[model samples]
Target: MKQFGAKIQSFFNSRLGFFVLAIALFWGKTYWAYQTKFNLGVAGSMQDFLLALNPIPTTLLLFGIALYMNGRKSYITMLIIDAITTTWLFANILYYREFSDFLTFTLIKGSGAVSNNLSKGILGILNPTDFLVFADVILLILLLSFKVIRMDIRPIKKRFAIGVSLLAALLFGANLSMAYSDRSGLLTRTFDNNYIVKYLGLNAYTVVDGVKTAKNSAVKANAKASDINSVLSYLNKNRTTPSVTYSGVAKGKNVFVIHLESLQQFIIDFKWDGQEVTPNLNKLYHDQNTLSFDNFYNQVGQGKTADAEMMLENSLFGLPEGSAMVTDGTSNTFQAVPAILDEQGYTTAAFHGDVPSFWNRDNTYKSWGYDYYFSKEYFSSGKNYDVGYGLKDKIFLKDSAKYIEQLPQPFYAKLITVTNHYPYTLDKANTSIKQTDTGDDTVDGYVQTAKYLDQAIGELMTWLKTSGLDKNSMLVLYGDHYGISGNHKKAVAKLLGEKTFNDFDNAQFQKVPFMIHMPGLKGGINHTYGGEIDVMPTLLNLLGVKNTGTVQFGSDLLAPNRNQTVAFRNGDFVTPTYTKVGSRYYMTQTGKEIEKLTAAQKEAVNQATNRVTTELSLSDKVITGDLLRFYKPSWFKPVDKKDYSYKLSNGLKQLKEAQEKKKTSVLMKNDGKSLADEYKTDAPELKTSEAESASSSESAAADESSSSSSRSSSSSAAK
Candidate 1:
């Protein structure tokens, strides 16, 4: 037994054994994180096997520095390397749990400001088993402290260490080349970070992000306002006028814009296993009070939902690659919807269940002229209440009633629902729908959650009717973007009963639901070809608002003679006749390729292509150059961010102050009560008794103070 113990100790104390041990520990933790923490998907291919082992070369190259050092210095180097790698792995695990994305240099640079706010939530993302990430390091420390392993003074030959590093570097090159071969043009194209992490590894993703960040920083720094002038001029010349009939139709009505997360147009009236996918949405669509667009497409870029937001607000395109919300949101100026509405005697508020800083929205919303921003701080903090994104759809809509009612009348409010977001996870208890098992977990999960979102929306609509908000409010509902990407189209194709998915099918998949409902209005399905950028102008026309001098790229869909060439951020376009992606133009009705086009068809395609490119470039120029700051419209007023703060209870504090000043708060209108009381739900997160208790306590305190003051005055008189 003593001999066995001595042999084990001797092996661990040796140079080669220590080196191998270090590599094993680092790789073990990284691979564990990759499997357990991240959503890297099923490892069913040779490429997947390679990706699982991708961290090895990088780890070896980094930790090999220990071999060049001697004695305690070498040991110290190993410790430092282990600590850094462990910390990096742990941080990414937490970040991935929240965002389903790897950490970029841009995100890390902005981390400090948001870290304190997100720390508690960060702790929640971790599990008791996650301690294994540090278990190896802790074991080493204990072993050294107890003399279980001894350090030798001898150093490894410098030449051998250098050779090993060179070998690792060569292996990395081979790994990268193989990955590129497997997923052709993997690094060159602009794609989601998931592809990068799935092909290479987390370490490769960080390096790629750093390079992209540096390039973007240079591009931003060198951009000039002069570069935007030509683009601006083109838009000014091409901008469409408002429809004569619809103008002023919904004037002075409250606007309730509900952002349906990851909803596609196909699911509007879709059914699965004898259940409607979105029954409430279908009802809203068929209602005489609503105007639904059958061909409305989502033209979002890399920002996805955030891109849709920027388009709806500014009538401008998102960046062609990354998120404009993060890359340019803080610095660029916007002639957004909220700011425009603010000029028309409207109060603006945005309610999102996710963290305000998720897309740098906390600061961007301030500049966008939102009067109040309710985010994660305002939602239930329980783990069960949150699914993939933030609060569950039920809790988010119900709890928002408390803050929603407080907004002044004729307000512009946006409710972003995250229940149908990617990975579409719903607690079994909250779900009444079942998956149809289409051989894709994502697809199966998608149907169930989409049904859940529909139910939640139905609940909200019921409350709106019961509370009488429906009559005076114009509800604008739109899907942010596609729920599934092109990668998963095969499974979706099966679900849709299509034999094969093609480029023409891809175009159809981009369609998202867009509807506007005003209680007394005549409504029907409009067959206008439009995109998210067109939404702002269409809504503005209905509200009797004008974007006369602003360089909006989108034309109003309501206009009888509106331009129908809806441009995507990637230079694709869809018109009434055709869908143009790159050099290929497909017939809209038949989905057939035009092998030999007529002169007019060719001319139209060329014109549409140019228009799409020009629009995207100009939008990029506006964002990258911060040009809107140079070209402020006459009616637009710069937002005063001092009026709002998202610090703990700051929104509630502002409401209280407004009520005290008799500044026409809904709470005061209701005689010092919360509208949440009207919303009758048994959500465990809602503590109505506690809220009532606090209200009762306030009245009790007021009476006690009056008695004490009277008693004190009587005593003074006696004296």
Candidate 2:
């Protein structure tokens, strides 16, 4: 006891002993974290963990161990290593242009997280993971004091071994916890969000989160099971409600909606040199009465590209925050555009290049009412050439053609091409853009992929014309989101054209292109901006078919009433977030908002956000495929459509804000430095073009948009 007390006393008294212990534990914990998230999907060991700790600590811990063994000379080597790690961690948080823990709002609040440690001078010895070492140093300082310090410093065989064991245990614990934490975030929040409000405290959190999760899960299952009863009951009561027949196609008229991967709209502009990149699309714009929706933006968070589909086709919003569609376990719920077409006697099908299971698109399509689906695994294996990720665009198109031949008359087909995905390499790998942009894969790959996609589109268009379907069918295409193409500016510049392709939606991402080609309605254009969510209903209205608005949360752009805002979710969240509110027919993204919006404008924003978010309540249903055979018109209700824009109230509201911002900027600039109020703007010029388009559509929807009396539709067509 006396010796143990003396050792404890010595640890508190000796800086050298305390420092060594901190170093040992720091490196140990770090190595454990690194190993946890490495490639392995499992979180059993330290190394198998996903999202492991930063690597700085491990390096420093080794240095400390060396110092303890050798002598003061260790400081020279240790300092060099420490300097590098510190700087890197500091910079990581600072720039956060790339993802870093410090940059994330979710991670910023954790205790023991490090900051302000990066330095340029320490570049030589520090490995990327070294900074984790410094964090341990700090953590030790925070947790241990005098007597406790000695507890960490003991005999080399005993104390050091114990510390190592302790580290492994803690590390394993943290890794498991981390994985659990993510699952818990989604499971717990979902439980709380779903039942906490309705069932009172019965849905309270249970032990180890298992109780609440179990009960909550059961509730969800029960709730979903109940949807059928409710829907069936509703159907019986509403059986008297007759469905309109869908024979609207005038001869060979067909519409094709193609969703591109991460193609933002801001990729074109004369100023951006985008004119050449999308020459064909641009050509279509001017030659055909093409309406380019300039302020069109996607607000999908997480599941970035898929979210575009969620919004565009199903009028569904982004997923919940922190949960991924890939990991959400529970599939999303909702009806798809195919259901309506199936009722109308059109073949409803879906096509994709990746494993249908990746995003659960396979199961999801069934729920969305797709009568047929072609996923990567089940795609015709005999088809040949450039088998990059899963299948090439050319092959995708070729495969699509095969399906088209077998498709029923007046079919509604959705083809999602995936050749544009990362690594951007093709059989004919083009590297011209790489020379100019240096380190930008976004540019290099985008140019190559965009060109490839363009060629494919041209082929598809040509085939349609040759097949004699051109005059009878409509074609629409768009991108999911902008690429994280290693080089943003150079890649965007190359693909969109340095001049015109410069801006798509806004500087946040390249604006996605939404192309609409209708049979018989050829050369007719509406420049009004919209997103994926609006596509389904808009098509129904354009085809002049009675749209079954079951679970729809978007305005029908083609209806022409043009009074409701088009809403989108940023594709970065698991839950719906980052709402984009454009005037029902407006295309302006940038302007001075000096004053706050009036209550009316606020209400509009609320309406748009809520209308989109309400879909989250049933995302699980969409993914589960239970609702494929059933849907409701009221579920997809559009906002109140009326010509309220340009009213004195809205104009005055905007005018007021502009004046306020102008005044504030002047006030702040009085000092030496200039201060300007900044807000995100896609552009202010697209509004006029949008208006021209909207005016035209206004004539089309003058009657239908207002006649919101629920008209029913069913997947089953009784012969």
The model with the greatest TM-score is 1
The global Cα lDDT (0 to 1) of model 1 is 0.80
User: Candidate 1's residue-wise lDDT over 383-429, tens digit each?
Assistant: 46777567888889998988877776778999999989888877777
Flag regions of model 2 displaced more than 4 Å.
1-252, 268-275, 287-292, 322-333, 378-388, 423-439, 484-510, 522-525, 568-590, 593-719
Cα RMSDs of all predictions? 9.3, 25.2
Clashes per candidate, residues 3 or more apart or on different chains: 0, 112
How would you encode candidate 2's per-residue C-alpha lDDT over 429-475 as one tens digit per residue? 32222222425654555555665665566667666655555666677
**What TM-score fits each model?**
0.72, 0.50
Cα lDDT, model 1, residue 483:
93
Q: Model 2 — TM-score against the truth?
A: 0.50
Q: All models: lDDT?
A: 0.80, 0.46
Spell out the clash pairs found in candidate 1: none
